[model samples]
Target: MSSEATIRRGVRNSRYAAIPNHVFEDSRLSMEARWLLSYLLSKPDNWTVVIGDIIKKGNCGRDKARGMIAELVKFGYAEREQQRADGKFGSSVLVIFDEPRDSHAAEIVGETSGVAFLPQTDLPATVSPSPVPPSPVKSAHSNNLDSANTDCQKEREGARAGSEESDTSVVEDRKRIERDFKAWYRTWPTSLNDSEQAARDAWAALTPEERAACIERTPTFISAVKAIKGKFTFSSVYLKGKAWEKLDDPKSEVALPTVHNPFSRAWMAGMLAILLRPPLTANMPAPTKFQLGQIAQGGDEADAVRIDRLQKYGWPRVNTMHQRAFDRQGVTVPPPLVAISEGFEQVHRDADLAKRWKRAFERRGWPWLPNTGHEWFFFPAGEPDEALAKFSEATARERGDDDAA
Candidate 1:
């Protein structure tokens, strides 16, 4: 398992040591802070300890140890002491865990007993090559005086450090709030459409200050309202105005001017025209002027592919070829001819050709014939000769020619 995962698992399994009174002054103990407290209380005071030494002993990264120590100090679980430059014993505040049997608890007991019993592991070795006489016993009062001085100095240093950190955190919080404000401002929209009620509802949930910032940064809400109204007009009307009416509120509605403006009308109409244009499908190719002319002249047998290609390549002359053929053959071309001609027109505008073909089919005694929009033009059910004769006369009239009797 990864080292982080191992540490997390260890933390979960271990019981939390009771928080010290000093630590409770600051609210909340993070997991790392609690871990540091436990690790500190588990050991005797002496081990030549430092932040780096703790990292190596704990099997944690140096940066992680540093962060943990900072958090411990922030929550008052640990305190730092200042060492004197002379290498003599410096001021140090012993961190007292709330546990009854804590290392610091032993130290407190020792102070009252008038005998400081240093942990065996922390004591320096007494070394001598030859027998040496023992020194006279020092006064217990003097020892207590030294320890108290060191503890007081450590407490003062810790308090000063805590104050500095608190100031820095306050600044960081203010900056974070400012960043959130800017982000909210940039995303707020001035207008909403009929289908955007959910989005508006979400926006309304923001605080008044946030909403004001959004309105200031976005375009005027009136303009947005007008644009939405214009774009949704057809769809709203199709539903008998129910869609637009749903957005109205008797209490909160914003009043708009009633004056008609030509510029606004023109702009709205232009937008509508663009919106209503047929979308080009993946399979459809753009038509050329030549292809359009071929569709106009060729009765039915026109080559739609050839006309499509000629139009795509911007060659209008190719359409004149089909028109010339139509002129020479006259209007009464066979059904095969009419089919091809209709197909050419269908490539550019299927809806227009479908309507024309449906009308022609109905004019004949083929009202029951099924039509597939614009895919094919149906021939009436009858003898081939009779159908052909009727088609020829119709074609001649359609082409403004008199060849068909």
Candidate 2:
């Protein structure tokens, strides 16, 4: 027999996909990717592909399944768009295209003729408005003139009532907007309130509901700015950009301490706690003057803001510069300490150890610096060897430093 494999033909089943020859013949896609595309194409229009279903069918691990999906996406077979629900960020919606989308294609899934994979949600069903009924036909010569006069009078009265209500509503809305604007403007940092007129314009442009959202979300946004120690955007700029949409519900921010006065002892203490903290990345040397100058020259403001947030909020607030800093030092940076069920108990026990370590650390003329997460204690050099060794071993184990090693 020849080296080429013998071909066999089978009857085409209704379930089989009628895929184009190019899907398999294309050099850009791997055999696995081709199979995945074919499998997806075989599904009925608008059929959602669950990752779990794909994993089960493919007999592959989650990563391998996801990798195949990603490969399809990379080759323009699918697109994912982030979605928002009830004013908070939600899971993405995937849209699969028969052909690759162009750069100028609409981002909205509904706009294109593509199969959408939407997550099933337990939200209440939406009630659509009822359609208007057709106007009743007029009967001739049956007290028509009297009916016409009565209808005209009713119309005039309704018009007068509606006009008065509309005028009153407009006045009230304007007053509320002005009152709310003043208060919101005051909440903004004094240094960044330069564009009052622009802010007013932006505010006026929003619907009543949007205005309420901006007002409600501004406090959390302010706290985030304060936490990062970043420069504030102009009120107008912030309003226009609608940056508040990205924030979580203010209820989740209860952990943040309320600052009644910035100069108060408690406020100062918290700020000191933040400022005196150890650097986010170990072995990241400080930038030299020349390097600093270069950093300042291009995109410094944005970079500084990003780095500050990362330092304040831990590594979940990612920063490439910090990653590179750790990489250069040959260090595997650990994720921020997020206390789980048993870890919470460990954190409480470590509290006493932390206090003892702090006392010893201070006696050695070293500053007591907490990590960003405030989950671990500081380790200053030149303390008693026994205390040092005990604290080192305990902290190393707690921080997963030993495991990493």
Candidate 3:
């Protein structure tokens, strides 16, 4: 047989109420009655006990509250005396004691004690009450009780202050968690739809260190999922499983698939033309013709570098560039560049590429080589009609296509 042991602790300078152990030890009293008795005893001697107060404190219905009080009264832990005012019967006032009183002794003591009872004027007409007057004399024991009550009050005040601080900390931490969750969610390739709330809750449950790990490892996970052609799971399930924890660091992952760019110079120029559209570029300073060419060339080179990195080191390598862009300039990787690096199939459907390029050039006020019949274009709002003549002839001579030109 297993033996059980009991342990007891005594309070030192800490705030606490003193109660007779017999109250708890008594088998005759109900647990509710014992608790109610302890609560009453913890109050100051002159404190009034009301049924409403008891109901609120115990979170119980009126019937249960009254029943507990009746139990205490039956056990001789409390007494009630009906009042008389102007020859009319009034509501009874109650007195609770830390120890039970004998019925015969209670009667004699009530007659001689002259205990004061406060009236409840604001209460229902059933109990018109008034305040109790303070006693003119204080004994040494009364002074000691006052000191203990003072300590209890101080302890309560300190506890309340600490609780407020703790609540503030919790609020601040939740705000930070929500902000980080939004950042992480933005990087997810697919929509979560209905699972968003559950995902947020799961993310909130993670420790700060775990959250950081999850955020840092997400790109690698995305790469793996894409590599295997696996379907993405709900964000809630991902977070709950701590899926990022199982993946190796992005730097060590290998066998990345090669990504290829499919945009020709003409197609790229058209895309760049859309990027530099008036409505979008209105906030940007107008670039010179030379500067526009440089911008297009530079943009193309950057896209090529990103594609190369994606093929060599996978998504994490390219995602690091996105992170750096945001961290350094508070911006995201440009959409066109992202589209080009993720898939070449999108660029393969190029049958309408030249038509779209023509439309873009027309909208942006650029014109094609006049004699060459709109084969090549010049940029930056307005250019001479023969702007590409010299370059086209030089290209024709190089290809031995002078007669074709």
Best by TM-score: 2
Q: Report the backbone clash tally of model 1.
A: 8
| Candidate 2 lDDT (Cα, 0 to 1) | 0.45
Candidate 3 wrong stretches, greater than 4 Å: 1-16, 103-405
Ranking by TM-score: 2, 3, 1
* Candidate-wise lDDT, in order: 0.34, 0.45, 0.46
1-405 per-residue lDDT for model 2 (tens digits) = 111111111112222466645555545667887787777776543333345445546778667877877876787767765545588654444555544564433233223433332333645234332242111222211111112112221222222223666445545656776898888888877525377777776676455567789889888778755543457778778887787774532222212323222222222222222323344554345665765766677785545543543354432212322233233322211111111111221222156665665565444333334333334322322233463554344344223221111
Q: How does residue 191 of candidate 2 score in lDDT?
A: 26
Which of the predicted structures, 1 or 2, would earn the higher lDDT when compared with the native?
2
Best-to-worst order by lDDT is 3, 2, 1
lDDT tens digits by residue: candidate 3, 367-400? 3212212233223222212323333332332222
Worst 10 residues of 3 by lDDT: 1-10
* TM-score (all chains, Cα) for each model: 0.19, 0.26, 0.25
